[model samples]
Target: MTTIEKALIRLHEVDAQSRGDFLLQTLDARAKVIVTIAYIAVVLSFSLTSFSGILLFAVFPIVSASMSGISYGQVFLRSMIALPFIAFVGIFNPIFEREPMLVAGDLTISRGWVEFLSIMLRGVLTVQAALLLIASTGFQRVCRALGCLGVPQIFTTQLMLIYRYIYVLINEAIRMDRARRSRSYGRRHYDLSMWATFVGQLLVRSVGRAERIHRAMLARGFDGHVRILGHLRWSSTDTAYCILWIGLFIAGRFFDLSSVLKFL
Candidate 1:
């Protein structure tokens, strides 16, 4: 198959997975959305000094990714790429204010260092929460959830458009990469100018394609809003899940269970 065709097939596979009827398929989309948000809120509320608490909370993403059939390695790789930006912005806490605040037998660490570590942990927890949310819930369901939550129609529509086009852009980039490789006889060459040219061409093509898609939407009676068919129902299972996690989060935050464990 051609590169574009292969890319299209892969896109279809992802869509199928998103819409698939399976074991957890019966779970209400709204419940998942609410629980996912609640999960993030709980994770982010952790005390910066609470290492064990953060570690315990990490199970959510790991389990969610595994259960969703999404590759953990892929999520990790994406996290690695996206996380450094946050780290760089937050790492300054450890750089200045070098006064010794805590003694660890032979070494003294400053309060600044502690704060910086807390910031780093916060970033990881927040990012992982978001990653799990997207991977498990899928973009379409997320958009629907957002709409139900009273996010403006324009914003939801824009989000939907972006989600739909992201795969298209990815496919375009992959096809371009494949074409480049074929033309170069399968030799890996990093030509900056050529890459820039290819990206420019892809951007132009994507814009043109978006125009065509817009026209197609108009032809099908899309008048600034697309009706989503699925209705969101919150069930007993969702309520239990939310309450359990929220209770755990509150207990962990207030009780400092990790510190108690250390004393044991």
Candidate 2:
């Protein structure tokens, strides 16, 4: 199978996770989205030097994965996609801020290093929380929930469009790739020139395809708004779930539970 085919398969597998009959899958998307946002806010609010406090927040993802029946390994691997950019953002912290924050006997640790690690942790946690939210609640539901939460209609509609057509984009790419291979005559590798030509072809084809798709949608009475199928009702269970998670997040953010336990 081609690499693009593999990518499409991987995408389908990830999407399938959101459709399972798991605990999180059954919750209201609005509640899950709200709690995920609250959790991210709490995570970002932590001080750079509060490494221990951030460590404590790791429990949220762990417990969430356990309750939702999501695989930590898969989530962790997917979350690593953001690591390179996160590293780029903080790579210079150690060089710019060298004040010592910790002393272990003869060894000294710099504040910049701590802050860099803290930033990395924060980025990973936030990204993973979002991934979990998407895995538990499908992207369409999340977009609908965002619409209900008063987000601008255009933004939500664009998100839904991008997500819904990603498969079409991939399938188109696969077809183009197969055509390329068939005509490449014994050449299996693409040089820079070939890659450029391939990209140009794909772009032209995509634009034409998009125009046809828009026309078809208009012919079928397409409106500006995306129409989702199900109703999103906020039940008592959703309220309780939101309250429990957000309350925990607030307590963790302000209380410094790690220090309290030490005093006890």
Candidate 3:
């Protein structure tokens, strides 16, 4: 099969796999949205100094990923892509504060190190939670949920449009790359010039495609907003899930389960 066909097939397979997951299908759009928001809030509220607390909190993503049937490897790949920015923000914490704040046996660790580690852990947990949410709920449900949560209409509409068009752009890029490889076979190694040319051509084509998409939208009477066809009604299952997680978060924070574990 052609590269374009292969890309399309892979995309469809992913969509199918996501659909086959029972836990993902159980939550309606609103429920998924609420769960995602609540999960993030709970993860963020933990104290940085509480190592055991963070470790206990970490169970949610692992369990969710398994239950949702999403590939942990795929989630890790996405997380790695975004880690640098997060690391950059947290790396400085360890540099500025060097005083020893805690003693574990004979080893002393700086307060800054604890803070930095916390920041890094927070970033990873937050990002992974988001990725899992999107992988399970799908992007359309997320956009709709955002809309329901009172995010500005314009922002949600743009998000929807960009997400919808991203596959088209990726397919176009793959097609262009294939064409280049076909013609360049048996030729000298590709240099910077060839690389720049390919990227520039892709950008130009993407812009043209965007223009055509805008015209298509206009023709369809799109009035600067996307209208989802269905309404999301929250069920009892969603409420239970939300309450359970929120309760665990509260318990974890106040009781310091991690410290208790170490004591035992």
| Among all candidates shown, the one with the greatest TM-score | 2
Best to worst by TM-score, what's the order?
A: 2, 3, 1
Runs in model 1 lying further than 4 Å from the true structure: 1-26, 46-53, 63-78, 184-200
Best by lDDT: 2
Residue 164, model 3: lDDT of 71
Q: Candidate 2, overall lDDT?
A: 0.88
- In order of lDDT, best first, we have 2, 3, 1
Model 3 / residue 167 / CA error / Å: 1.2
In model 2, the runs with Cα more than 4 Å from the true position are 1-6, 181-193
- The C-alpha local distance difference test score for the whole of candidate 1 amounts to 0.71
What are the Cα lDDT values of the candidates?
0.71, 0.88, 0.75
Per-model C-alpha RMSD: 4.3, 2.5, 4.1
Candidate 1 scores a C-alpha RMSD against the true structure in Å of 4.3
Please provide, for model 2 over 1-264, each residue's C-alpha lDDT reduced to its tens digit, 9 standing for 90 to 100.
Answer: 877898898778768988888888889999999999999999999998888898888888887787678988888887888999989989899899899999999999899999999999998899889989988888888989999999999999999888878899889888878898999886777899989998888889889988998999899889886677769988999999999999999999988899987886
Q: 28-76 in candidate 3: lDDT tens per residue?
A: 7677667667778877887766555776877778877777887777776
TM-score of 3: 0.78
How far in Å is the alpha carbon of 3 misplaced in model 3?
15
Model 1 per-residue lDDT tens digits across residues 39-157 = 77776776555556766666666766666676667666656656677678767766875777789899988867776766666666667667656655667877888888889999988
C-alpha TM-scores of all predictions? 0.75, 0.89, 0.78
